[model samples]
Target: MSPAITETMIYDALRKVIDPELRHDIVELGFIQEIDIVDDYVHLEIQLTTPNCPYAENIVAQIKRAVEGVDGVHRVEVERACMKGS
Candidate 1:
């Protein structure tokens, strides 16, 4: 059986996701707005620097792959958000 997934594991995995343009990890850039785990399901929010972010898909895909790589992750629900700077 796969080992149980933990919040630390999720965050650590996300730390490896780098933003192509910024050349920094999404976590480091404060892109990860929220993270929650319900049973084996993982629901997270990734806030972008802009609504029409060109790298949105790539970032989401990276997050999905990372989260799914965890042993006990049954599913991942990624909600995208935009935070436009003033």
Candidate 2:
């Protein structure tokens, strides 16, 4: 069986990714909608408070960097989604 992805690892990695506007980690801000690991790749669905948020690209880049730092991660794929309300 494949090893499970621990919540602690996920949270720790995500904590390194900050939301520029909120001045807090994306995990703390609750912007990470979901995380999925398949093989060695990590897929992330990230939700921003607004569709037109100025820091969207920066946030995505930071998230990719953070996730890629994990020991078993070979690639990081991040998809952006807009939150229901800003």
Candidate 3:
């Protein structure tokens, strides 16, 4: 298999995505679970602290924008998943 995307870069990009309600980057809040990059497309699985997270959509959009802003990224796909104990 090819080398996986660097987790540091992924986390850095995610730092640009902030949660409106929390007024903080999701990365700092431990929201991002995984990131996969393939053929210049970024796939992200994000975990929200709550199932009814008020800023879920906004956070996803922000994450998409942040990832897409990366130099080699052609597309960004972000999926929101609820945290188990949330």
Candidate 4:
């Protein structure tokens, strides 16, 4: 059987997703709000620096791609939330 999926594995994968404007990985930027994993599905809640960030869509896409590339990940769901008072 394949290795079980874990939060560490997912986080490691997400570390590769970089913020285009900040030029730093999202994980390092602390944009990841939450991560929920069930079976092969991964749900992520990300907090952006701004509510109207131009790269929001791109960031979401990159997040999904990054998580999807992880072994044993069959599906990915990403939710975005703007930082409070930002």
Best by TM-score: 4
Work out the TM-score per prediction: 0.89, 0.85, 0.83, 0.93
Model 2, 1-86: lDDT tens per residue? 44556556777999988777788888888888888887778888888888889988888888888887777777889998766754
Residue by residue across 7-72, what tens digits does model 3's lDDT show? 677788889877887888888988988888787788888888788888778778888888777767
Candidate order, lDDT descending: 4, 1, 2, 3
Q: Model 4 misses residue 31 by how many Å?
A: 0.5
In candidate 4, stretches whose alpha carbon ends up further than 4 angstroms from where it belongs are none
lDDT of each: 0.89, 0.81, 0.79, 0.91
* Residue pairs in collision within model 3: none
Q: How far out, in Å, is residue 23 in model 3?
A: 1.9
Worst 10 residues of 3 by lDDT: 1-10
TM-score of 1: 0.89
Per residue, candidate 4 scores C-alpha lDDT tens digits across 1-86 of 55789999999998999899999999999999999999899999999888889999999999999999989999999988767875
Whichever of 3 and 4 has more TM-score, that candidate is 4
Model 4 worst lDDT run, 10 consecutive residues = 77-86
Locate the minimum summed-lDDT window of 10 residues in model 1.
Answer: 77-86
